[model samples]
Target: MTKPDQIKNRYNRVARCYDWMESPMETAKFSKWRRELTRQVTGNTLEVGIGTGKNIPYYPEEVKLTAIDFSKNMLKRAKLKYQDDPRKISFIEMDAQDMIFEDNTFDTVVTSCVFCSVPDPVKGLQEIRRVLKPGGQLLMLEHVRSKQKFLGRLMDWFNFVPLNIWGANINRQTIDNLKKAGFTKMEVNNLWRDIVKLIKVRNIK
Candidate 1:
């Protein structure tokens, strides 16, 4: 199978248990980060890799939210969380690397621990840049490779387990990947000693 297919398959297999598997971090840290990121977005917002709809409850009522996931099973789980909500929210199955949205379509885009699982991070990021209006921003709460040599090497060494089990790379150089994807105006703040980060990148086109 292709890389994208492999990722999709893996996440599909894990969708049933995805939220449970992430509960530890979700409770201790990610929940807070998700709230901080989701609550701040405005206008037409797109959420890439909206796995199990973890951020759904945190979104403000006013934003017209569109959440996308590549895995059908994952999207199914997400829909359950959002089904009864009265807000303007839509869910679609879409690959981040090749979104169906028109150019300059969104005012803000949000992601939570998503880039690590994207098969082609730069391509996915570029697609985000493509859909974002000029002056629009991408808000991300991601875990990336540490800059510290020892910790970085450790994450690299054990990257395969999560890559196979979760379809996520634990050592992604996301900041550099952002630069390569044409997001030059950025603010990166460490949330967990350089491993987890809260990033804001403006689409300066």
Candidate 2:
């Protein structure tokens, strides 16, 4: 299988248990960050890697939303969870690196804890930039390689195990990758010790 396919399969295999594994973190910390990041979203929105629909409940009711995930199993679970919500959300199974969307299509793009697993992070971000209208905002809640030397090295050492077991890398330089993807006006708020960041950027195309 290709690398992306491998990653997709990994997520599919874990879809049923994904939320359980994340329960502790989500309850204590991630849920707050997800809420804070999603509440800022407005206009027609696209959420990439909308895993398990964790951010769905937090989005404002007025915003029109479309969400996608690479794993069909994951999207299936997400759809079930949000099936009865009042606000409409379209969920699709799609690869982040090659989204089937027109250029300059969305007014806002958002993601939560996603980029770490994308096989080609820059390529995925480039696709996000492509579908985003000029002046559209990209909001992200992501964990990256730590800035502190010892902790960063520790995360680097631990990353390989998760990459093999769950298809997630704990040592990605996501902020740098976003810049490389061509987003110029950006603001980053360190949510937790410089590892988890709330990043907002604009597509200036």
lDDT of 2: 0.92
Report residue 27 deviation for candidate 1 (angstroms): 1.2
Worst 10 residues of 2 by lDDT: 1-10
Please give each candidate's TM-score.
0.98, 0.97
Per-residue alpha-carbon lDDT of candidate 2 for residues 82-182, written as tens digits (9 for 90 to 100): 98888879999998999999999999999988999999999999999999999999999999999899999999888888887779999999989998999
Which regions of candidate 1 deviate over 4 angstroms? Answer: none
lDDT of 1 by residue, 2-102 (tens): 29999999999999998889999989988898888887798899999999999988988888999999999999998987888888579999999999999
Best by TM-score: 1
